[model samples]
Target chain A: MTGRHPLVGALSAVALTFLLGPILLVVGVAFTAGDTIEFPPRGLSLRWFAQALSYGPFLEALRTSLLVAMAGTVLALALGLPVALALGRGGARSRGAIGTLFTLPVVVPELVLGYALFQILMVTFRVSAFGALLAGHTVLLLPYAVRVTGSSLAQADRSLEEAARGLGAGGWATFTRVTLPVIAPGVAAACVLSLVTSFNNVPLSLLLNGPGTTTLPVAMLHHVEFAFDPLVAAVCTLLLVLAVAVMLVTERLAGFTDVFARQEADRWRP
Target chain B: MWRRRTTGLLLAPGLAVLALVFLYPVAVTLVAAPAGVDDGGLADRLGALAADEHIWRAAARTVRVAALVTALCLLLGLPVGFLISRSPPRRRAVLLALAVFPLLLSTVVRTYSWLVILGRTGLLSRALTGLGLTERPTQLLYTETAVVIGLTQLFTPLVIITAYGAFAHVHPDLEAAARGLGASAGSAFRRVALPLALPGVLVGATLVFAGAVTAFTTPLLLGGTRTPTLATLLYDYANVTVDWSSAAAVALVMTVVVLAAGALAARVPAKAAPS
Candidate 1:
């Protein structure tokens, strides 16, 4: 209320438009009656959307994308929950080393990571491309799972876990009954983040996906290479709708983006 | 002992994935750099890459584009973040959500919008032609300018979110105190709030730089073959030319540049400008 300078307010509005405007343009183009992609569409029609859905390849790719994203989120959460618990409760010395190790995947260039995985998994180990794709998404999503859950764990009442221990509850029992319930919201947030990240990932999927394993984004990339049509726009619009749905769910989860902000802040701390 | 074992048990699964999937692959890639040369060493291959004007040109373009995008994001994001931080709690929440929402969309989708807007048959060309600004549609795609615009849009949300966190930590009262002491509104922010928020903003800028340099989708689609960046060049080496050795070398270059920037960001003291 106090620092509301008109100049800053107007400029911020323009900045927000710049951020959101292009996506709006794509959505507009999706409903074109004409064959080509143009603004002010050649009059509106839902034909592109119908065409996009009816296209067998796009549907197949969507199925693969959903399968990989769901599996990747599960794998990341299963692996990352424990890391979160360790970082939350482990010794400070080990926390620093392990935290750095976990953060390395995110800090490094993803293209490089994709290439490295391609060489190691496909070339050296003879792993199936689909398996490699799943592994890559899980690795990429792991940091989200760990960071989000760790934030929740940091806020949960440790005294409850301690009380359970003092009352002759075993470690596993205390974790399952007390700690898990308290941080369930955080775990849910982590799941959403992991799911969205895995679903939208491009570079890793681009490298790891072969003929049978192509995800939606990679499929779209290939589609656009030869043809820039309304169908791609239609598919992209559906993705935009899904993204909005995901954001709504994030809002329901409470402080979902705030968890990311905390992660950024924590990274700078000594 | 029991507690230590429990913690280790909790940590093992994640660490195993990190070691086998993330760390091992990266280490192997870095180690493969020298394998590209038949008789010469990594030093010789790196020197050759350095001397090659084509590689250098792409590298320069990559840095220039990244710097421009980082500056643009900081310019646009700083004011927006400052306003968000100062707004009432309800407004702050809505603004934060709006700012962070773009990140939920895939980078491919975000970059795809640019292709629609900037391609020869796209909206900008048609608009320009309609306005009689040009005799025909202007070729905007596959240019460095297009890459800058696309990358800036892709990254500004992240910068805003990061900058909001930075500004939030600088309480509004601190700026008001300066304003009360006879400073102009501009001076109050410049002298008081800006310094406090610089460190966090720098972190965001660093991330944007690293992302711009490493982003494969934007550069590939927007910049195309005519305007190559290190990212797309790496793609070309592996996919088009099938030159694994050169690709490995380029990948290492990208890795080093990003890590160095990160290290530099880390060294900037948190409270650099003390009142």
Candidate 2:
């Protein structure tokens, strides 16, 4: 490998700062004792953090968001894992077409998706807000689950399954004992990534929300619209920490770059 | 026969989900765009709406903002991507993880952070005042510049990651050979590496532009009421006014523009494209 150039090193530092500075500032400002959002706080305190906890709408929205995200991730896994397995194992020509179809959700604009889903559910089907939100999040997250698990399945050693079968194991038994264990890390990564994607989603949540069913991000949007205070920063700080923790767990399980690298390969493969 | 059945069964649930949630709705939206019109046909009404000056202004602004964001991402991401690709494996992983960590957070949270930093009494304004760049707090929020800054920060990492993926495949010896053949380092990169990386740059640019054009939170929060983009206009028509037809028109225009850009981007040839 070549030695790092000084210019590139400097640019990296600047880029990191540019990317991470505002986020850090939000976390820092959450500790402010003052009423307004001041960068260098008058005095550090946990007042806003306490306020964000007790806030009724914020907490309710948080609950709704969590539940929806959990439901969506579970459904995506149920559907995506099987599809990934099929695509990985089958030597069919339709694999590419099916994969592209599943990936269309990621490529389409979120706003358009939201608008379309909102009309279909609200105007046509008359589905409940919670159900619509769950469906929307599932659609949004399915691609991630499929891609991650598909890569994992692609890389799994097939000989292990054959060996298990040779040892008199049935298909279900071999899959449970052999294939699932090998791809467990990838499945875990997919779950974590999809959960984060579902939780942090805004556009889909915005259109699908009904009375008393607003998600956290949509609630935050409304809160910011009316108020500008440290409480908002406090809420954002908590979520940011949660996101970072999820990412760290994903890294520990599957290695972060492996996820992206696999995604890149999947996208560019002929 | 059993394997075929199992594979088909496995794909059934996902296909059903897409059919019900994605394909059906999109089709309904496109087909229903002209519905409920009385006096004029759907086409004429859509054309009239398109001719409105406000719609044109928002469309132009959306394109301008998206273009600027794409350009900024490319300028900042290329070098970082190149550096990351060249780095050792361990260091590269750490760097990439750091770069992508922000993307995992909710865009609402990220945009809110920008609000704090760009507000009149926010960090950027305070810094400018402290440094005597301005005698008083500057109005940075609710401007196009603030929107661009926020978006660029949000998207630059994506560009870097995409570019890095492309650059990773490019044989380093190609550049080495060019340099050995009397080309300067800069020219060698421009001649060999840049062309090889064009596909990625185009992909990244398309993603950035689409994100920007379809963006609702950043423009609404950062650009304020004064700066309305197509997303905001669509929201206004669909939600605020409860006018579905007009909203559909706006959405259709936005979709067309984004798809056109993507199509054009895909048409650009990369040196590494397989014959």
Candidate 3:
């Protein structure tokens, strides 16, 4: 690429500032001593943070979000890993159709997905709210796991597996020893991405959450409806910190931007 | 033969879960779209929805907002993606990371931040007043402008990332060659780089448009009662009115629009690597 002009660089910097401005403002407002959310925060204090921790619904929602994210990530990997393996090894002809099938949930709007799942779980089967949320999240997140793991499997060197097989190793043993080790980082990336996606989800959580089983984002939405206090800012700030930490870890382990690029690339690979 | 069987065996569990949880539910909802038909059958509900001015208004508003958001993302993303792709690898990584950072936060949190920034006493108003632009704080919140801004913030990163991938595949030398052949830098980019990057731009537009139209939290918080998009309309139908059929209808509309967009995007020729 030709070197970027100074004008483009400056403009990009301004755009970045615009994108990050509101999020940083939220974090700053969380420290306000004032009851209302204010800019410059009207004298800095951690009282709102304390209140966020003490708030029962917020705490319960936090716990529920963590549990659901963890469970959903695990389930996504279980489902996605196998599919990824199958698609990777099954070769060229059927890959496009099957991959699209597995990835259908990713492109489908969350509003639609949540609406459909709500009807099935609540109206049809009468499933528990928690179970429904977990199921919804797992399906929502499965595409990420499948795409990540499938790409890794496709990119894995065939020589090592061949070498293992040449040494008289059984298929399962060779896979467990060779293929698993190579794809473990991809799986880890998938797990982290799935957790983040699940935790940050709103429409699905909103539709599936019942009394006493609301996820954090859903609770925050309901909380915002009745009140617009600094307490909510405080809670949001904590979530922001957690998100930053996770992104940092994801960057260190697997380049965060590469995930998006890889996902796009995977879709077009015939 | 054995390997194929193993693949099937491995896929069976995931497929089972997907069918039960994802596919079946969506099929059920699609089938239930005609549930409220009285005497006119499916046509009756469709006619009723078509007659409902509120639904048409909401659908039109959703399409308008989504289109505007996609246009804005494309305008902003092109330069950012070019800059990122042209930068050194380390700087490129940092820029991409910063670009995607906003996406890491929850939609509620991001939308909530906008509530503070665009509220009457929020940052934008305070800044405007501080700068003496207005005598009183303006009501930026609860406006369609707020919804557009919020959605753009939420989704622009996606455009940049996808466009960067497209730009990366375009050989840098192609632009240089064009410039060498008497084309100005701007014209060189327009003639060479832009066409090659069109596919990624289309993909990004598809995603941003779909996301903006289907977005709930941002419109709910920022647009408030003033701007009711189809997503929120569906929410009201499902939750407030307990009208599953109406909600199903809205969901189906959204799905069709999104799928159509996706199909159009797919038709864009893939990135053309310079020979």
Candidate 4:
């Protein structure tokens, strides 16, 4: 590794501040005892946090967000696990093509994806609003599901699976008894990553939302449109804590920083 | 044969989901893009989209903002990446985690922070006025600059991570050798390591640019009514105007721009990948 270069280190400190300052500012603003949002609070209180929690719309939207995130993660994992197995273990010659196939959804903008889904689900297919939202979140989480789980599968001991097969086990039994346990951590990582991504999603959920079906992020967007109150900041602070928790869990499960970094680098590699 | 069958069987459900949920919908949009004009032939529908002036302006603004965000991210991300790459393993892990943690939060949350900082009564305004930089609180909100700043903040982490991976792959010893031969650290990084890392850096830039162009939330919230990007325009067409045809056309335009950006980046020589 290059020795610590003073200039690079200093510049990075400034850059990290720029990157993280606003988030800290929002967290501070959330604790304001004043009726309005402000950086330096008039007084310190958790009234806004109480308000956000008691707010019916936010609570409803939070429930919807959690339900969508949970269902989306499950659907993404169910469909994605097999693809990961095929890609990682099969050594399929068309790996690049399959990768591209799965990547198409991601490469397309979320705005476009959301609108397209809205059109197809609500307009063309006449699906329920919640069903469409769930479907949209699932598609959105598909890339993470395939990539994270697939990376785990790639690192799993292939010899273990072979050993199971050689012991007269069928493919199903070998997979269930051997491969599944080995890549279980990766699967868990993918699940949390997918859930968080789904939960935090905005554009897709925003567009796909209909009567009585608004996700938390979309609800926050609507709330902020008219109100610059601390309640929004309080809600945002609560979500921030949730995100940090998810990041820690993901780190313990799979070293998400490396997983995410490598995922993007490999994804966009020419 | 059995292996191939199993692989195909494994892939089928995922691909099927992709088709039904993603591919089919995208196809529907593209096909319906021409349907913006009723009772007209395909050419007339196409003509309407081609003649739409508002979309063209939004497209231009989207590209401009995206380019600005990409450039700013690259400037900020490279050093942070370098710092991360050169750190000890444990610290590197911690630094990388801090770098990307913002990504875990919703864009709604992140962009809200900017709304506080950039609004008339926000932090930036207060700071500028307090420092005698301005006579009064300045409204930076609802402008392209605000959109660029918001997006740059949002995407820099991605660029940092990608740049870290790229710089990590580059042999630091090569830079050291160049320095031994009388290259200053800056010159050494530029001549020895940067060329090696350009491919990865360019990939990061491309992704950032594409993300910025297609981004909805930041532009929608920060840029608002006074500024229009492709995503926001598409939203207006779809929701406000109820002009599905126009929305589809805008989506098509956005896709082409993003793909073109990707293709153009790919054409740039990676120069030298680290061995």
Report the number of the highest-DockQ candidate. Answer: 4
Whichever of 3 and 4 has more DockQ, that candidate is 4
Model 1, span A6-122: residue lDDT tens: 888988999999999989999999999989877878899999999999999989999999999999999999999989888897764568767777777788888888888887777
Could you tell me how far off, in angstroms, the CA of residue A7 lies in candidate 3 after the best superposition?
2.4
Give the Cα error of residue A44 in candidate 1, in Å.
1.1
Q: Name the lDDT value of residue B159 in candidate 1.
A: 81
TM-scores of chain A, one for each prediction: 0.94, 0.93, 0.93, 0.94
What's the C-alpha lDDT at position A48 in model 1? 98
Cα lDDT tens digits for candidate 2, B98-139 = 777787888888888888889998888999999998998998
| Candidate 4 CAPRI classification by DockQ | medium
Q: Is the docking of candidate 1 incorrect, acceptable, medium or high quality?
A: medium
Q: Which candidate is the best by lDDT?
A: 4
TM-score of each: 0.95, 0.93, 0.94, 0.95
Model 1: lDDT of residue A137: 87
Residue B252 CA error for candidate 3 (Å)? Answer: 0.9
Candidate 2, pairs of clashing residues: none
All DockQ scores: 0.61, 0.55, 0.61, 0.63
List candidate 2 stretches off by more than 4 Å. Answer: A1-3, A91-93, A166-168, A260-270, B33-45, B269-275
